[model samples]
Target chain A: MWVIKRSGEREEYDENKVKQALLRSGASEAEADEILEKLRGRVYNGITTHEIYQHVRRMLDRKRKIRYSLKDAIFSLGPEGHFFESLVARLFQETGYAVRVRECIRGRCIPHEIDILAERGSERYLVECKFHNSAGTRCGIQTALYTYARFLDISEVMPFASPWLVTNTKFSGDVITYARCIGMRLLGWRFPEDGGLESLLESHKLYPITILAIKKDVRNSLLTNGIITIKEIFTKKDRIYDILPELKANEVLYAARAVAECL
Target chain B: MWVIKRSGEREEYDENKVKQALLRSGASEAEADEILEKLRGRVYNGITTHEIYQHVRRMLDRKRKIRYSLKDAIFSLGPEGHFFESLVARLFQETGYAVRVRECIRGRCIPHEIDILAERGSERYLVECKFHNSAGTRCGIQTALYTYARFLDISEVMPFASPWLVTNTKFSGDVITYARCIGMRLLGWRFPEDGGLESLLESHKLYPITILAIKKDVRNSLLTNGIITIKEIFTKKDRIYDILPELKANEVLYAARAVAECL
Candidate 1:
């Protein structure tokens, strides 16, 4: 059977590809096989890969195996980069760094409102968060280049450990190649081959609050109130119902707990 | 009466603004007055400034008092920047600069695709063309910043007079301020309050053949055949028929001559 890709290109469906993805998202061999068997029985002649992905995610989610919704949850935080910046700040903070989000600093040439300013002991990091509302947009070489340039300007005034570029989307091939050649640190979706934002979130258990089934207004209020992570959801059990009012405190906590223990 | 601005803001209609724009587009004072008189009969409450602009353009086009369709013509040349790049190269060449369009050059850090590299006497210019397919999108500060950064990289390999940025749209306020501060030359629609792309084209009598009544395929073939400018149509009068045998040579020439003598 043929499968349509996100770009609307069609190719023959590959069961191995589906299994690999399921395994990557923390599913077991038995679970992957079971999901694929179910999928084989359901897929049509020209089913979209997105539909296949959603099917697997739903199956996994039903089995209490989280798909992370890592990319989607981050996207939910934005049509703007504001919440993503806060999330980035939290990630840095949780990783044992003192962090600041959206702080304007004097560079050698001009002032820059840095997305995340992170420091662990003697190592200071300058991070720029590039958030996209939709999927399939990659952070290009130009963004990486400008981030490096901005780092240069700021470094002249005050040195940094390295310039860190973070994003919700993937980075282009040139971005990956160029950043490696120059010493710019990059963190984004499934990049660097070994350690990307997915690994970062999974390794640290730093799931965003938006990963839970929070409504739009409630999510905004949560971000505004600085309940950025799942840990914060459990921590702020008293205040969440006050902001949401619609959600019972236990249901939200239970959901947050379920997401945290996805692995 | 209140008029709707491009940003959808309603403000009292100022006839002087329209008159001044008409005058700037080479309409005589009497002609501007005549156009305004005609506009008064048709405008409705909640009518967009775009509609007003279009109505005036129609009247001017009817009188053979050409509005240049300068922005629209440039937009027609693209869904890609290829034709726009060619147009830019021609503009530079017409102004006595020996230009190379889309050439790769060695920069300080990496390779750069210098869009229009122009050399005149001892002065060399690295021109970057930022072409937007649609209206109402301005080249932002980040673009300006990155362009400057790229220039700095290229300048380390070979010195140019300055990095020249050309666009078919306006620059954001910070871009304008920053570029002016850094002495980077900017040419785009209605910028610098003096000479812009509109002025450059007018001063040089250089008009892209897309401005004339050439159909899509014919225009593409014309561009491919190096019949970019209207003056080229006149000069290469023989070849114009060969490239577009569908169009009568005399009619095309007549239209070319009309657009050329718009001022």
Candidate 2:
């Protein structure tokens, strides 16, 4: 079967590709085989990868295995910039810190708009979020160095505050080393092995709304309006309905509850 | 007499320096001599270069020679970013073009916020404003190249619109050559020699309020509220008064009139 990719390129579909993906997501050998067998029955001559992804997501959602496919949902949160900042801020807030997003703070040399500022008790964190919509991109040394320089300027005034750099994607080895050397906390999608962005989100039961199986434009509209987390969608359901009035009330509520169940 | 420099180094006050600056401004040798003689009585030990600048500015303001000193006034308009974009937008408006500031246009690859979009008759221009707060900085080839890429992405959609790069400071020779080769119009502090940013502002009798000698915080507050041009200050005088309630009414009105006189 021919499968269309996101970039509009066509490629031959392989059952092994599906099996491997399921296996990586912690599916047992028998479970992976059963899903592939079911998927094979629905194969067509020209099916989009997005269609296949939705099919798999639905199957996983039914089996309570959506947690394994949450990464793909996060990737849907694009074209990236401020939306990612909001996601990071929401994540921090979920962990019991008061968060401020896109704050313009005066540094010693120049003024900078910090992505996230989180405070818990006397401890404050000035976060620099580097978000990459494409999984192929990685945060590098240049980003770490620049963040460190800004931190140096800001630390003069707020010495008690610490600098933390977070990315939706992973960081390069050089960036990790430099950040470690400077004592700057570095978080990525999956870098610290035991505790990265995914692990933290899983720990806090905080999943971004982008992972919901809704229309892309609806997800983008919600993100644009600073609605990212499942909790936000639940709490601000009326606002979400107001922004996307065309979307049915039950549909929005169902999607929110569906994603919240996975979290 | 001692004079301080921008770098904070102190040097003996030289009459020749004053004469050279005035001569560069198109003052005749005799006129330069007369200005220097008048300035001699005001010289003092440990006097700052900024103090000397005020004396020279007063002399120029009196003689309507403020054109020569307008660059310094432009530099005063920052902790830079969006304020400079507003200034450029205002400049385009003064030149009889309908302008849009911070417009997000959809490009082929991604969305881009064009700093200024100027439309006049059948002509449309996509402008990128590179603002540098420090005098020592210059817009380089990287900026030119990156801007060219965005222009290419945008021009596919806006085929009629040409790309123009404007900077508060000058451009390096390499950047000028690259831009010229690509047919991208370039504007900078002293670029194109005859009609740079300074000349453009002077020709149109447009000057930003940063040169108004008000407290930096007040000027910043005004710029933050989208008040950049002298006309904006005059028209939005109440907004300025509201932002700066601590300042007496006469103080704001007097500063507005003082800057207006130069224009």
Candidate 3:
């Protein structure tokens, strides 16, 4: 049986591979064998790895309290997260820096639209945000060097500002090394020794609205209106029922409060 | 007095600036003063810096034995040097490497049209040729990084070949450093410490047709026919009169011989 990979390449399905994945995801050898047996009993020809992944996730979510649903919700923000850049801007704002999104500044040679420019006291940061919806994609060294070059050009005009590279996913090893060598600050999902985008978001009590158990259309509507965080949703809690009339006022407030607590 | 700069900015024309430039170009103080006096008498309003540079070059050319005219001929290749990539491929051919111009190879991720692929004695080189007619413009670090990334993609499939970036102009310092760090060989005009494009052409006895002292139309026709080097002209010397009935047989041969001597 051939299974389609994420990149659309079809390979012969191996039962051992599925069992190995199950075992890696905290299943015992016996449980892995049981899952493999269950999967083999069903039809498997011409199936996609995505379908298998979803089935595995559903199975694991039932047995574990790992909140895979919340993670999947975040993953669902993929194509609909129009306010992701604004969400990043809000995170910077919560961290005490006055943030501007999509600010155009004249460099020495050319004009550059910086994704986020944050200023706190004497420190100024010109940020280049790389928002990749897929976890497989990464911000590579080319992006890092390109942003650094832009920073160099802008620094000739605005010398006080430092360049910061912010990405929704992780940066490649080459990017990290080059950034370190050139003294560029990088913020990615799991980069840096101690802190990264996730830790920063958690510490600043900022949670994206995608994590909420609200309706997709309601979340998208709020995101379109520049409301991205749980804190933003909490502040406009009274109008939540008006925006999403299908949900009860108490339920909306309760979900907002629950998400805000996690933040 | 006002003068237009290359960036289209107008600045007050300083007499000392002209004099300083003249002095730097091996002119005596008296000669500099004489040139400044003559320039002052001419109508200088709304004159571009390019016009001023042309005037200075003309004056310098009159007094010097060095062939600045030949260099200007190379500059005249502007926009019409579509066959420059083919010319570079020819250079590799002269250097005993079997070359393929504009060979499209399927990389691991995307298809890349390598400008020149030179293979000789079990060694293959994937060369990216950047042809710029202007001397002032340079290939920067971004191009280097981009080429390196493409090489990385190609290497996943064709791992034996090396990546080489060849340009008709100089490379920026950052490009040099980055290329050195990444082990991508860069060849440009006056770039590497020892050998550059000019030195390479000289060593290999390959001179571009652009540097030949011939009529513009004839040069363009030859270039259009994929004849880029003096060596190619020499090979086709017997039919030169047939191609251009306007020119005498001796003139074409003379021009070809002169350029070949320079090589």
Candidate 4:
């Protein structure tokens, strides 16, 4: 049989092979076989790798078989973070963008945090997440103010770029009006225009970050131990598979390159 | 020239003479004169003794002319503690009900906590104030629960009494409906039915409690000197009024009789 993946690639489907792969990924033997049986009609030759991974992930999550460590990595939103990153991760996934939450901005002796950084094709967005009842001067006017500040800090050595502020709280009425007046694209939580809080993630079409992307991203990023910023992933001009494995094989080379370029 | 007194009562007109009276009450000569100037036509001969005292209180508040001790006392919300007291105080005053921010609850060991309790024409209302966000249960329902609980407590002694709940945050839709279903009145920071906060006070024609009332009540209850709680006031009503100089000696005897019977 053959299956078409989310990425529109075709893949050969072999029940035993799929079951073995799921087992290797920590699913129990019976669990893996059960997944294969459930996914029987969905498998096909030339199916995208992403589709295969998705099948395995959904199977595990449905069975409540997720590992604690794996769950933490999936949900982590960096230090002292709020729930906005979770919302962004969910929404971006629905928008067909590959999203990662709390990817570290690594280069120098000190590390930085990005709330979320997502990419689709060559397009990438660096996002800072904020949640507030009413926006205040410091955190309100520019939700991404901190991102820009971080950018300035790393611009000297890293190829620093691509940032946006994604907030659960809307900008102040005056600030929103002013932003529009000044031609700044303000995307945030607001009613009617964006479906308010109740329908926020639903309207964005991202209910949750799919588990496959989460597993693969965590595996690759931890392999090199060199921090991956969403910026680097977007700027690579290639699929994460191509870039991630190479960094995994040669951590020293990747780290050197990352440090040499100002991000 | 006539002057309104501290009790909200009108008195004989004598601009300089009333100024001297304010000075005798510890106001600076200049401030006393200034208060008297503000008091000019507000007074009329044969004005009630209570009205004369109220004029002084208003002048002091408007001009910020009271001694720091008295100022602190007025702002403290004596027996009604917490944000609810402040909200009720503001609401009651805004509604034109001669609102006393904190009325000392006429008891021993009740402590000084102002939770806005409004009184008009022999009808006394106790209000519990709450300020909450969308995250918690609605203030309306919560307040209604408290009202029921308080009513249960008081009903054991005197049956069929209800208290009101005032909140700074607006109620949730379902919570509001539920509150209405359960026969609870919901008040927001502003409501047209209440004639808005300020107009509510205007219509009620109520004034703040006079210092004399506070002093009289405090001494009668002897709250500052150590008596506290309604129970104590009831039990010790026999000698309560004699200790309070501000009360007419006869009124004290009558109040003691009332307290004993209520108990």
Candidate 5:
């Protein structure tokens, strides 16, 4: 069997390798085979080895035991700045809000950067990651502007209520007050005594922004597109997308990309 | 009348200037009369005009309407750095923690460069300020170590928590995770977006080394006794101060000086 990976690569799968990975992820051998079979046609030539591994991992990620452990371990090490990103995603998921990590906002003319965009029902939130030694008030302002820009790019179809600035460290009083004045939510993480990853994992509210849900239209688009590639979706542009509604063009692209990728 | 300014200088006060300032701060003439009279004895030679104003501001800080407006308008923009410090103090105060700004800590044989030791309940937090555009992770680490040393010297309280590294900029992921693993809380003010004041406020946590705190106590005792001047405080010999907790010889001298100063 074979499968495609996130890097647009394909790889041949060894049954033993698949079984071992599944076991590590707490998945049964039979279950692994079932996943491999389902993903067979999706595999293609010139797939990197890591892609093959990722394919199995993504497949097993659907299993409750696999998903929980995989996330638990991933969030524990605080790896590649992905630790907080994953935490944010899981938090959005747990809150019953549809969340997309690394949703690119773009327009016909330009590209923009935004980390996690979430939506629930009519409420939408634009979130940016600030993984620093400490997140000062300055971070809040940057996030506020970024979110506001994102809001401008998207129409009322954008589901979040306000822009959010979430950081690993606490925000200064002035920054918090400024954000409040500008209608942005500034969230900070308080330190624990141990200063270990365990302490961080124990706190979910520290993940920064948590929205209620995404727009039904956006959500449907993502589910239907089955977006797995980064380039096919998420453009990097800031052109206005709407005239009557006066939306930034980049936001529409992000909405499209997010809908295409995660159902 | 005379008062000390933030510059550590004293200057004479002008009555007309005082009257004009009181109006700016929104004090009624009757209240201003009472303040001028109350400040009579406390005023001395060579008081600065700014000091007189600060004194009045401190007094008015007790009032409600005036206090809020003062915080929003005057203090918030004054000296920018002081504003942030005051903000930090207020945040801690709201959290039921008593915060001390610009308190120095040093061991007997060491130089005194530490600043802002905040005590909340049984825990002591050491904060060092850095106001700059670019700062590295090492700066954060150095502050945390010094804070740890200061804690051990002063209160004999040993903290199990990792020291904190608070800054205004983000750090490399490896550095942050490594610092966290070794028991350091890397905190950075999310800068520009928040405000650039985090670099002005050093915030971190560290283990307490009682020996270091005691060393500082003895040095302070000597300096307070007139046996040594402020300049001599940093120039003293190495290995000074009685480190033997059970046999505190320097403490006897400290107590003796206390009595003499009282006399």
Candidate 6:
């Protein structure tokens, strides 16, 4: 069957592609194949990608399969950097790095509040989390330049540590060009292609609790107490009232269970 | 007499200080003294600086004496950088430099939208204007770093031109430190003490029309049509409706006439 994309382009619908996406969202191979089989007659020629997405999404949702809106999930953690910092620290930790969030370290000239100090193998890393409140706000050359400058300042005192610029959103062209020139490690939404934040999240299964469909203030209250995983909500279902008011907490728990396996 | 500052500190009121400020605002020395004389006895020892400011501002308004709200006047020009760019270009022009605004210049690695290109005796300059919409939005180390990076790129192609960072707001501490270390010239609200943007504006009479007491949309409309100077409003008083609707233009012209000599 052919599908029309959001961009209005038409292409042949690929079942294998859809199955891989479902597997990424925590479906077993058999379940992904079954979902694709169920989708076979439902998809017609010229059906929109949006319709296909909705159709598959509803089926997976009924099976308690995770639905991914990973971009907005990350944004929900900010206007402030603290929760986002914790999320980044968690990513490093899950990948076998010992991570510390928000440590004030003395640079050569002054004291700098390092966002995340991640150590693994022979390398220690200074990670800067550049969080934005809204979409379409790309990290520009200045962000890259200043991160480099901070690295220059701190490396004088701690020569072993490497600098990494991490952002939840995209980056402008110059940022990537400049970072490559300086050999700086960058982990933005999809800058490095194979090793971007999205792929990293999928592979490491470091899905943030912010991924659950929820509001900012509620997300803040949960993050304030160090709750950062959807599975944590499912684990604490009985004590829903402990996190928030009983009714709201129960609703959050229900929401969490819906997307708990979403990677 | 003594006056209470906004900070709750008490200080002796000096007439010459206010007079100097008034003169900076285009008041004649005699006019400043007369205003000060009128201010006597109305000022109680416990009178707050805010009250004294209101008194002087009201008196100046009545006499058509220039009143300075220099900081806010600059802010009224932006969330966008173009008007602020024009103002900066005007400053350099008034200081005897030949100026061009918003030209695309080729850097070593890429094309750059150069905000202002200024040339005077024996040298040229690449001037970057960093304008913010609101007060307390400061230029951080990243701005300075990215600006320096741009300079490094452009200076290779045009070695005679120096780089300058100008802003309507203040600079963070690291920005100043980094700029000083690199010998980059900075023009901000109050940095160099003798030669900050405020003192420069005072000396050069580069008062912006945005200083007029009007709404942002009205200010934007005027700025959009390249009407930047306060005197320009007085010049176009008869044709006020030409720039905007009759009523708003009339009000604007009235505001302009009140502060026309305000430097």
Top candidate, metric lDDT: 1
How do the residues A1-263 of candidate 3 rate in per-residue lDDT, one tens digit apiece?
89987667789988887776676445788877776666776638889877876676656633221233333344555664436678779988988899889888876655667888899999999988777766667888668756876787678889745789887778887677657665789988757748877667656767677766677777777777777777877787756656666455566567878655543
Per-residue C-alpha lDDT of model 5 across residues A106-165, encoded as one tens digit per residue: 522123355777789888887766655321223433344334444443424444577666
Score each candidate by Cα lDDT.
Answer: 0.80, 0.75, 0.70, 0.46, 0.44, 0.76
Clashes of 4: 71
Measured against the true structure, the TM-scores of the candidates, in listed sequence, are: 0.91, 0.47, 0.47, 0.24, 0.24, 0.70
Residue B207 accuracy (lDDT) in model 3: 62
Error of 5 at B131 (Å): 15
Among these predicted structures, which one has the highest DockQ? 1
Candidate 4 error regions (>4 Å):
A1-263, B1-75, B78-128, B131-165, B168-185, B188-263
Among all windows of ten consecutive residues in candidate 2 chain A, which has the lowest summed lDDT? A61-70
Error of 4 at A122 (Å): 29
- lDDT at residue A32 of model 4 (Cα atoms): 68
Better of 2 and 3 by DockQ: 3
List clashing residue pairs in candidate 3: none
lDDT of 1 by residue, A40-155 (tens): 88899899877887777788863234553566777878888888888888888878999988899987666788989999999999999898776668898789878887887788
Worst 10 residues of 4 chain B by lDDT: B105-114
The i-RMS of candidate 6 is 2.6
Candidate 2 C-alpha error for residue B41, in Å: 8.6
Model 4: per-residue Cα lDDT over B166-218, one tens digit each: 65445555445534543445565334254433234323422222212334545
* Best model per TM-score: 1
lDDT (tens digit, per residue) of candidate 6 on A1-263? 68886567788988887887787666889888888899997999999876877788778753334434565577767778788888888788888999888898766555678899889988999898899766458887777766776777678888745689999888889777767766778998876887888778766766677776677677777888777766556655655567788778977877876654333
Error of 2 at A150 (Å): 27
Which 10 consecutive positions of candidate 1 chain B have the poorest summed lDDT? Answer: B61-70
- List model 3 lDDT by residue over B1-263, tens digit each: 78987657788988887776676445789877877777776638788877876676666633221233333444565674447677678878888999888888876555667788899999998898777766667887667756776676677879646789988788887777667655778888755758877667656756677766677788777777777777877788755656766454477678777655543
Choose 2 or 5, whichever is better by DockQ. 2
